[model samples]
Target: MTAIAVTIAGTDPTAGAGIQADLKTFSALGVYGATVMTALVAQNTTGVQGVHDVPAEFVRAQMRSVFTDLDVDAVKIGMLSRPETIRAVADGLAEFAARNIVLDPVMVAQSGDPLITPEAVATLRDTLLPMAMVITPNLPEAARLLDADPAGDEHAMLEQGRRLLDLGPEAVVIKGGHGTGAESVDLLVTQDEVVRLAAERIATRNTHGTGCTLSSAIAAGLATGAPLASAVRAAKDYLTAALAAADDLRIGHGQGPVHHFHALWPNLPGEKR
Candidate 1:
């Protein structure tokens, strides 16, 4: 049976982040992709100029339509721009009882534009956190979610990951890509263990959609029946390779996107190693 993964996120016409990135990740990982746009972002690799959130009722309707018709195996959520949107999503997930929900707490964009409202942060923590199988937040987003100082060292990042785990997600992945270091270290904190995934930081500006891609890839892996740890491990591996093979071809003048299809192509698949 073909696995289906749904992404509840904003629409990025630039295709770097949000629903476009999630769908691309799902497709690359061989999972059928579905989406519910929570907001529409008018920006690209450069920066975000405007954001218009979708009506909460319409968001619910979209979820209903997808859950009613498809056998969704997993879900990836990102860019819920409003508290009402977050509540509506939580309601839909409860109504449908979707499994393997991966939440990417997206607060800021790669261009440093704020993607989420300050008030919506509480709603996300209280409403959506409990429903997530795993929540992926970058260092800055994690700080925002926890209301902690954003100037954290590696130790602080791990502490924040542990704190986020208490908010109800079965696991938390604190992405260290935003940290100031030569190596990017993502910490996965569960109730029982903490696993660290460290990789050499790729010095490329083409990392616009990394978080969205990672979360969606993890969702696809979960939908394919991989365990939580295994899914995260695979996701980290995939994103690392994707970053290393980033299309420095410069699609846009600003921060470009990762080479999502680097693993595909006639002979390039083996080159991923």
Candidate 2:
């Protein structure tokens, strides 16, 4: 049987993030990928220029079309920019009783551009967080979800991870890429156990789709029937490798994208996606 993974996200023409990055990650991990677009973004490596949202009804229609025919193993959600879109996804997931939903609370872009509306934040917390099997949030996003300042230390990061778990996710992983350190550390907090995953920080400017790539990679793992801890560990490893290989294909001038096909094409020339 083919493992299937679906991504609900916005579009980035640069193919560095959002649906494009997600689908690429799924394929690279050997999972069949599907998509439902919530918004169309006009942007590049530098910053976001504009956004055009899809109707909530249409988004739901896309979900129904995919779920009805395919036995989706995992669903990866990103960039729900409106309250209506968030509600639509929540309702659709409920209909499917989605078990392996991985929620990436994507707020701002790597270029520091906001991708979601202020109204969607509360809706996302109250409506979608409970349905997620795992939620991946960076420090600032975690703070926004909890309505607190960004966690300044590791202790605070773990504490906030616990707090996010209280909101109903089975697990929460706090990504440490934004923090200052020689090694990047990620905290995976759950009701049963908390695992701290750390890796040597790779110095690279090609970090445009880091969050999207990691979350989608986790979804791919889950689609392959891997346990949550194992999935996260593997995803982190994949992200580190992708980041290291990011310079292999310098797509844009500002920030480059991770080489999702690095393992297969080790010496790929820098080509525009």
Pick by lDDT: which candidate is best?
2
For each candidate in turn, the TM-score is 0.95, 0.97
Best candidate per TM-score, number? 2
**lDDT values of the candidates?**
0.90, 0.94
Clashes of each: 0, 0
For 222-264, candidate 2 gives per-residue lDDT tens digits of: 9999999999999999999998888777688899888888898
Candidate 2: segments with Cα more than 4 A from true spot: 268-273
**How far out, in Å, is residue 158 in model 1?**
1.7
Angstrom error at residue 239, model 1: 0.7
